[model samples]
Target chain A: MDKQHYVLQAKGVDISVNSAQGRLPLVHDLHLDLKPGKVLGLVGESGSGKTITCMALLQLLNPKTIQIGGSIQLNGRELNGLKPKEMRNVLGKEIGYIMQNPMNAFTPVYTIGSQFVETIRAHTPLTKKQAIELAVSSMAAMDLQEPEKLMRMYPFQLSGGMLQRVMIAISMCLRPSVLIADEPTTALDVTSQMQVLSELDRLRKECGTSILLISHDLGVISALADDVAVMQKGRIVEKAEAFQLFDQPQHPYTKKLLQARPMLPMEYEREKLVI
Target chain B: MNLLEVVGVTHTYGSFRSFRRKEKAATALSDISLSIGEGMCLGLLGTSGAGKSTLGKVILGVEKPTKGTVLFQGQDLYTMGAAARKHFRRDLQVVFQDSFSSVNPRMTAEKIISEPLENYERLSPSELKRNVAQLLEVVGLHADDMTKYPMQFSGGQLQRINIARAIALKPKMIVLDEPVSSLDMVTQTHILTLLNELKAEYGLSYLFITHDIRAAYSVSDALAVMDKGRVVEMVQDKDEIFSSQQPVVKKLVSSILPEHPRNRTLLNGDVFV
Candidate 1:
């Protein structure tokens, strides 16, 4: 396929940090392709450079202490070395990000309404009244209850699950083309996880928003990812279609990762039968 | 004999005097009742804000309930005398979700594990060292790790240290609050397996509290599904939960994504736009 086929593509990407000891290479030779409206899953153990890879794409990495190399093309536009002022226009307006901890994502002192409205106004030329309307409607779209009441509450007043949904509402309000969710559901409960995953699924289907989903849970990846990339020690050990990676893993690290998941008894029995 | 019994426990947060005019006191746990027999595991499954942790605190005697009784071996936990309360404290231990915050940063693995032992028992410096090393070995950590600090260990390894500390007093029952929830796929399995082995080897009863159904089912013999500060359903047999028709039970169970994409029944949409 041509380079224009994918909405977001990374080639020969390298990420490293400068420390007192020396330069340390954190991620190496990373390549990823996200076709329009498709979900690409990044699965790896903790400290495997998954978050760094996503941050580098958004130009969120600190240039003073960290150096990111290679080409990151978003909608045929180079994004790796974009200036901070230019990058600000691209982030949130072009690509949405859902962080792992929703608590830390928002300012604790600010009400959700002020923050949400401020975000909407920052991205678009909407007036404050229009931004508030957009925020309420977007929150309602995510099935949040009492949007008006939630608007007045501070980040500390909301539960983790509620806060996460609010974060998603804010991210998706502007209808970004690509969403980068880094362990979005890791802090949520099971029921809330289901809601968040379904919302992500809906965005891709209804709005044609591509997603880069990063998680350590294989179950979460299996539910949504069309393609899966297994990372180990800052390298892409294996990349395949979701079913192929889960069913017939080729790489030893991928195999070990798949086997390490705690399976329910019914799933275990099904595996026994398949074998 | 029942190792622990939570009889008609009802706990409410915020006193009536503290509440503003429009706001009412929130009921954390309402008329919750259950019991864990000797050497049995009871998994409390619920969503966030579902009062699972409140119930854990009530059982551990950290919080006095509004209108219920928590009996530890037939003795009222809150109303126990000082001597009995000391016994209760030594017998019941807890491991919280965030291992790093739960432990003191400056304390070495040895000092952290031996904290409980030092409080309850009298041991010389050399004997205490040996005991801490033995405890570390039982939890599958190296004896050399005793000198390491909390930051030097991974999340899973730190959780193991927490577990070693909990079992240091040879407590009869341990309240594990989301012990494996913060770990990755591989490390979660390792910790759950370690918990199961320790339970079998020590004949310990666990009030395992978690929102993850898979982790709960792997360790518990019985399961209780809680929703909105109430036990919506309780299953005596863990496998029987699969056939439960309760809405809360079904919601928690179905939230677990299938092992593979082919088996996924929850999500229904085309792969691409």
Candidate 2:
């Protein structure tokens, strides 16, 4: 069991961001862990600070207006005080992040291969040709159709689902100890969302990557998470096993989320109006 | 005649090159025929790019259908002249999806709601104040909130204001396009309940368009499932909708509307358009 120790752990972690408007503690006393080969879902609405907590895990909190306190351990190494360059070395190889908007992450002007190869070179000391080969094979491993063709194509040429799969493929190829995905499927259509989610699930099974999934969509969480944390207004209101949280949530916010959630087939619609 | 009838409507996108040469054109909505009754809500359910928004725009007279006619109260919508169309606008209103942008940032809530009333005719100074207050109250806002700006309110509150503006005109029918899609799920439930209550009070007919089938099921009395610009299946009752004969409609219905978690994802049953 000791071999299955946490790949990522945050204890009493607090994050605050400063804006011209004001400085605010976006996450308060947040404690979570990502054990190897498991998925932990951080569920909440907008402003609930689920994403902030994830950002704090990677020590990626904004430098201005953002204050991060507490311990963030990645593969038993403290990453809280590391410089940005050192952080980057730890980030992709130790902890991979799949951003919510795959569209904005890529440089629109460059080919997908250029950006991907650049990423590979940044971490691995590979020749230019080797980096391109790695990029092509990694993209192919992502289930992308014709990696060579995609290597020449721009980000806009690929659909959101394709881009997301590529992102996952790149992240997994690095074999990061921990993977954090922020609303990974939030921007896609249901079919596309399912496709990306299934890919993420596939990656977990194949690579045994510990995942921290952050989302406002409960259905997505329900489909992916083994552990669940329900957050509200920058606080974790509840934490439980996924099925337990779904079946018997303790937090008022969690119950409210459940009440507000529209079930499939919508049994409630059959009943008369009730507030 | 149906309270609202759409017969053989078709809309296409893209144009020909060389000013007359035909290029690739995609049919947005095609050969759509449907009838909605008074005081009833019907939802337009579809995935993205299913031409649900286009159908709503066509019904609202914002976009002219390439073919077919929309009969409102047994009268053709496009038959009227421009000035006549302006008059018809008073009876047909829209509550768009993005409530934040739908409202004018420069105007306060009162001005936003009363803009239509102010446009139709010049109300007396005191009467305008009273009318705006009444509109706000009808949509569950306080009388004091008449002075607040749109930014001051939450998304759910803003959506309420959108509804109030639509109902302020007392239009017989409303075209709602993904009204609560941007809002959180719980807020969506409240807004939907409020819409139902308002419909009952005003006897409004709604053409509800949304990608969320569960939302459509909750609020709409009947539903039409669209795929690639065609209404493949429609049912008068929500229960009957799930039992559709068409595989495209059934696949869509089952995939999105299920409450249970299956070992496998919802399948298309080897048939889909």
Find the candidate with the highest DockQ and give its number.
Answer: 1
**Clashes in each model (backbone N, CA, C under 3 Å)?**
0, 4
How close is every model to the real structure, measured as TM-score? 0.97, 0.89
Which stretches in model 2 have alpha-carbon errors above 4 Å?
A1-4, A19-23, A264-275, B16-22, B257-273
Tell me the lDDT of model 2 at A34. Answer: 83
> Can you list each candidate's DockQ?
0.76, 0.31
Candidate maximizing lDDT:
1
For candidate 2 chain B, the 10 contiguous residues with the lowest summed lDDT are B264-273
Assess the local accuracy of residue B93 in candidate 1 as a C-alpha lDDT between 0 and 100: 95
> What digit string (tens of lDDT, one per residue) describes model 2 on residues B55-147?
999999878887999988787888977787787788789999899999998889989888889888688988988998998888888988988
B16-100: candidate 1 lDDT, tens digit per residue = 6644565468999999999999999999999988999999999989899999899999999999999999999999999999999
lDDT assessment of candidate 2: 0.82
Q: Recovered native contacts in candidate 1, as a fraction? A: 0.81
- Candidate 1 residue-wise lDDT, A38-75, digit = tens: 89999999889999999999999899999999999999
